[model samples]
Target: MKSTFLILSSKRYNYYFRRFSFDFQNKVIKTKNLFLFLTLLVLSVSVNAQQNQVQQDSTKTEKLDEVLVKAVRVDADSPITHSNVSKEQLAKRNLGQDIPILLNYLPSVVTTSDAGAGIGYTGIRVRGTDATRVNVTINGIPYNDPESQGTFWVNLGDFASSTESLQLQRGVGTSTNGSGAFGASLNLLTDAFSENASAEISNSFGSYNTRKHTIKLSTGLLNNHFEISGRFSKIDSDGYIDRAFTDLKSYFLQGIYKDENTLIKALTFGNYERTYQAWFGLTAEELQENRRQNPYTYENETDNYWQDHYQLHWNERLNSNWSTNLGLNYTKGKGYFEQYKPEESAADFANLIEEDSDVIVRRWLDNNFYVINANVVYKKNTLEVISGISYNTYSGDHFGEVIWGSDLAPNTNIRDRYYEGDATKNDFSVFSKATFKLLEKVTGFVDIQGRFVEYKTNGVNSDLVDFVTDANFNFFNPKVGFTYKPSSSNNYYLSYARANREPNRDDFKAGVTENETLNDIELGWRFYKNKVSVNTNLYYMFYQNQLVLTGELDDVGSPIRATSGKSYRLGLEIDANIQFSKVFNTSTNVALSSNKNQDFNATINGEVVDLGNTNISFSPNLVIGNSLNFNPLENLQVSFLSKYVGEQYMGNIDNEASKLERYFLNDLNINYEIKPNGIFKSIVLSGLVNNIFNKEYVSNGYFGSFDYDDTSSPTGTTTGYYSGYYPQATTNFLVGATLKF
Candidate 1:
């Protein structure tokens, strides 16, 4: 067996070449198409043979049909479809990395990390939608919080260690839970129950004191029925930004029962994280000073937090052609970050009062989230369907205290408020979805989901005192989609989906409670061949009442109330994977997108002007990725990856308060493996070099309202106005080794 890897590292090598020799002229050069075909054919044959051999080696009670169990959105091998990243691939490169980083090489995916490294604050935008818009599932269960609609990957520290397989669905076709697949959906499955009890340990280190250590153990299959598996991991990093030190840890445990026609799984996991406030952006002058600011600065007063999750799943095949699955999921998360602010008559800093303590000026929150979700699925040839419901609940509280800080004062001056007051609330809702077949090789699916959301705050500053009463909402969301398979190797699809989101607790605390919604219409084409695959999609979106983050807020970070009259995104996405030959492989992802806030009208920084055509905040105009893999020797593999991001705004008002400059990033890696028979399958050594050129770049920032004058052509405010950019790491090098069992 041969391990596959392509290295595209760049170096200065001057090789003198004379006029073409007769031997060179006689040498054959293959076309790109031929190379792609051969590579696909070989890969398919190799993988197919491996599966057959593995299956043949295992003995079963009956000669049952070979069934492929998929841990993904759709469970079929439909062309123009899904790509599964295996555990081996995940571990060999960028271990302890976030899920988004694991999918960087796949089609139509653009992943960015706030830490300038893959281990923390990583995000993936399939096509053009942000992380919040993507539906994520772990072991076939939804993972995003239904209320806040945000996926905090940090909650699962070192989860990659426990994962055995993952799939990224680029377009909507299959039936699943909760929200429809607007941009893409990710599915991950942890390692299976082991046959024998054994424990293993692994550790790795990369840029920014980023390191991970994990241990895994599983009881071998017991009594032809039950088995258990568990894992623990700890990850710490002095984040790319100064002061942002991350100390995170998590654990996973599972009990499983499997047989010829039945499989039941019970699983639970949780994580605790404490990091200096890195969410806060920086100003221009700061960016110029080394571009990398420490997170534990004295002026930055932040809090710490931790969260946990639990789930149960059961699957059975009632008959040969009728298999069924049912799942129940629950999650609980609580944590907070603190800040310093001035005292006021509104009793704002009430929650921070420490018992038996003097008054001090400061603010922070103690937030918590809970969710209960269930789903069922049944599949058949030529027709596949799924239906399920979810009940989600969320609650959190905000408190203030007279800590050692003056309100609106520079240098974190000391101040203590006279009184204490706080606020809190809860929200709940339910939803359902299903899909069916239409015609030959064509399938259509429709989903209808609804949620009843409500929240409240107690104490002197509770109940959204400034806004209307009872800030509650009930919404109905519907989506329709179609997938056409023109041929066994070709597929096309079209889909439309819309979503409505209620304001989070913070949105209301600042006296701004508005419904922010998004609607998307999409169309795309897919192609698959023996060795190469491609997917391209076009999208148009509509934003109604989007919560535009106001640079200036009333004592809180919530955006001021201002409904976007009209805003849309139009773009094209193209992703392709090709292997030029047995020793070379390449892939590229490119997004050409344009987002504009049409007719944006509001009293932005006290000015009423038509702020239309302004670039959507945080939406980069262009994102691109390219990679090349090459193997110069049988034991050595080298690769290079390049990423580019076009300039973008930190605010919708197009002001100087916040904006990020265009930047490009590059990465390189090299690995060599030695296959030793019997005792060890392979001995591998690897190294990764990040920010090859040490280019300075900012991941994201917040805008300041004071600097902008209504579409006054907001210049890139490098100082004071913009909170701060997550300064990317400078060029760094790492090396590690692996021994297979």
Candidate 2:
């Protein structure tokens, strides 16, 4: 069955590629092999599964009858809250940027691109909480690693290709099944199975030689009872910063079987990213001398990563009042960045640089991670609830090779092979939530969760060492909220939630150099129609043995940190959306916040420093975002948006000298939907001008450890401090076409 499937898939791809000139590109050639494999799998599944059960169950389909986002007990929604950017909306807002950068127009949101233009290594902050605090999930499976709980957007380049819609839930939200939601929860729904047989070819190009090409295949009306769909895309770009480049590829596939009361689904996808290590940020002086110089920079280092995910789900209904959601997911990740180190001859450095070795050492990140989660949902006349549990484990080897060290004919030859520490981690969690309506206008909800985690590492050495964190434990956290709807268009809600978060790897590893904390808060809101909304949230986030990144900068330019007496965050956020008519729309958001260390005394470079009443590092006083849309003609529309950030300090001295200056930035987008949704229909468009004014502003960055000529030296020289920016990209443009058949 599989062999026959492969042959059929090959023939189809050959036919498809024959039409594209890029089919001959070097990268495209190598990539075609992988797609060939995917095509075979899809073909095999399509040919062998003669029944619709593999495509979808007739009963599980969205009837196109009821509104789901509104009926659900999710907090991301308010009568005034915004959710779901239509396919058209996403196309019109095309900034040729990463998901985070593209969504920067949202209220109280800020995005940073380590790769400069959203093409690689980008992140989004919601209401002050960074990506580390956000809960990201794709099709209900948690996207965050169980151990570090971090989401690397770069790993899934152009993932938006398969995504149909996404919702960002700010702050505490509806009871979710995975990691705690501290900052926000992003739930993504990938493209649903198409009902017909059609294919689309899309291509777009912009600044930095950045471009993306995509091919999608739909088993058009395949037997009318079954559908198979898949997407293959490749994206590459020359980063704004010197030496920065991105080469990435990704895939998405799904098989669905539907019936009036049952639904079964099989989904698989993955991505690979090859990039340069631009983490070593430049200094103001360095930025001037050579804005593109990479100090940690070396030769042949490719930050390459690949991930593959698989899931199976079955939805069954036993009766009118009871149903169950059964699912299983598995993810595997592999790849690493290779780096070169200069040779050294000291006795202690002897191991780092072997005798007669080459001029550089290569390092690799053999990281493989996976997770499994299962959920069961039950519903009654006025109550609904779901309980679930999950288990995850992963292992990674940070190994290296002595390609050369000290022996080469060069200024500083270093190359040798060595085993760096290899680490393995495991994690699990159990959670549940219930929602009940006691009266026609009243509803209540509660969720409880607990988790267990452990880890260990081997292969220790002189400067680098091994560590262990093997343990099993549980933390019980609960939340409660109420919603009242006097009419279909308006609703009032009050929610009180208490959540706890264990320090992930970034916190512990960057410890003594960074900060971490926990939060507790209450929220209130009112929604007036989907176009207008109001909210007031009072949160007193408390920290236990807080690790606050001080506003102080080390000689090396990394955020310095210390154990604080206590740290607290009190803040408020407000957002609104208004539609003057079908042709005009406006949205805005504001955040007022204050974060500080209550008390503490610390020593830096052997000097006693007072941290009492000092502001925490990277904490901003205010953030604002505004967007406006106008329709100048029936076939054209334009949008303008601006993001304003307040001054932010980098250290804890309450120092005014080292603060990042506030800046206002804007972007523009315009699109014309030609022949939209018609026979031989299509859309042709162009997007322009991101960071329209080209305002130069620095976002948050860090200072590294000070290097002393001698441990006893009074003045230690600071190596170049590394930093990142919410760099406003130079004005850019993109032109693309989408066709439907």
Candidate 3:
């Protein structure tokens, strides 16, 4: 295995599970349910006895100390519009689905799955902004690819099982690592150490031949100083669309050393995924005829990817008023997407081949990411200050090979290579943040950051042309805010922030591009009275040279975007939670927004037409989600979840023919837990029925126009539009169980 470091600390658990392997060419499958059952049963008996014999260690009662991640996380008094999902909240919905699906109900969030059932290739849009504009980090380490500026969730299968907490900050809330947060930022923290030794087994089965199995174990503190924990999971699912299936496996391991004044930690986690492609959605007419149909018909048309992460962290408390943290991180990622192209390609293949032939090709990407991050903090009676810096680099190679072909030269090898290219990016940033108490009930905040980005790429393009592009960008982001708290239960805040984002890899390929800028303003209030809690925020974001979707798709089905002159998004979001009674509780969120592109122009039929004040593509005007929970029995719970999305257009032109209709969806969930004497500590059973109403809906699509009348004159020529739709599944069910000891 190739990695940044080799340090295996859990000798006791090393014999239990072997290290992971990425080889899948000759994959084998074997069942060991019987052995798992008996092993867990025996461990249950021993764990119970161990639990009863262990005494309460004084280390467990020591004062809670802050972790190194606080340097990157948003503070309670940061005057930012954000939300937090605790471990308890995540556990309720962590059954084999992507993390985006679990956060679908959050304000201004929209989720879509390529497999149409939330198992393979999922996507998320927040406040009308796509995932590429969102910055994501895990335990203060940047997770977004520097070149693509995108996060591939499939590479981290079943990550929700290891996540202890998640926080989302909207509208470029604060300064952070990696790419700029043009729309929002999300941070995830893995599970904290357990004070007692424990073991868990979980299994799930659902509609469409879907199943998931997981095992987790922990070793309590040894010598009151060190602890170890690990988890392994496997998930398989036959998707709603034809041939859209997923088989995934992942693992997580951590070793920690903690004391009253210092903490050190090392971690390793990653996943391997093999899934059939479902990127080619159906046409609108085909969607009506057969909503479950998939256009891709080739066997072994799949995507294979694997990612591994390594991190070393150290934190020290110099004194009551000073603290510092240092972290080193590395990630190794490799993947390929295979495709089958039909015959008649000799002349079109840049004359690389002598004769027409049908061929199977694979595009591969192998990359390495390295980073060093450090931060220092100072706090006093009425003021706090933090200073941080980070440097990270990404190097990747892209290549393609012809694996099989109908016609070949006598000595031609199937592994013949073709197009090859590589890209490198270096990013560095420094930031300072401060908070001061202006009065007893009023506080002020300020943050400033300076960043430098360098991008370089050179290689042979698909057209057999030698291409090279080198770019450099410098950006300065500033933020200021104020918060007023008249009482402990009521609070009000207002903030303004400015951010800049550089062009990504795809953007460079299309043409020469410039950096984009955003100016955002946010105002929010929070109130809590008795059994009710409410939060509301109003935001206005203005953009310059923004990249907006133009309803066109590339060869691989990714949306095509063009630089718009100007754009803006204004929205209001509200979230509320209420406990109606001892047995009933409810939570709801609503988002209303107006997104527009000003003075957009396009060339059609040799004529330039100015489309004045058109709606931004794929940005809906309204979105609502609600959840109702009931606990009728001592250990039984039920929940109803609902979502509604308003009509929206698929293009910046806002043509009525390219509109996507509104949709309403509902889901039902139930969970029951059992507590018995002796060996077993707890047993949990859970189930989910999604889209209970069987509503037929299209969540995503594309539209474009072409000159139908090929007349030389611009006056008489006409244009026609075409569209493709991605329809979602009607109804499905998933049932699961968990045993802990």
- List all candidate RMSDs to the true structure: 16.1, 13.7, 13.3
Candidates by lDDT, descending order: 3, 2, 1
CA displacement after TM-score superposition, residue 255 of candidate 3 (Å): 0.8
| lDDT (CA) per prediction | 0.59, 0.61, 0.81
Error of 3 at 419 (Å): 0.5
Better of 1 and 2 by lDDT: 2
Residue-by-residue lDDT tens digits, candidate 3, 1-741: 101111121221223222211111222212253233223323432233233332432212112234555655676656889889987787777788889888988888888888888997888888988888889988888999898798888888888888888889989888989999988999888878777888989999998888989999889788888899999999999998877999999999999888777777788999999999998888877887888888888889999999999988887777775677788999999999999888746654444445768878888899999999887765544455667777888999988777877886566677676788888888877666666665568877767676778888899765556668788887878788989999988989999999999988878888947999999999999988899999999999999999877877877767777898799999999999999998999999999999999998877665798988999988899999999999999898899999998898888887887899999999998999999896879998899999999998888888999876656565667777899887788899999999989
Error (Å) of candidate 1 at residue 48 is 35
Residue 543, model 2, lDDT: 66
Q: By the lDDT metric, which is better: model 1 or model 3?
A: 3
Each prediction's TM-score versus the true structure: 0.77, 0.81, 0.90
Residue-level lDDT for 415 in candidate 1: 39
Candidate 3 clashing pairs, residues 3+ apart or interchain: none
Q: Give the per-residue lDDT of model 1 (tens digit) for 263-311.
A: 7878899888776655554557777766666434555455455667677
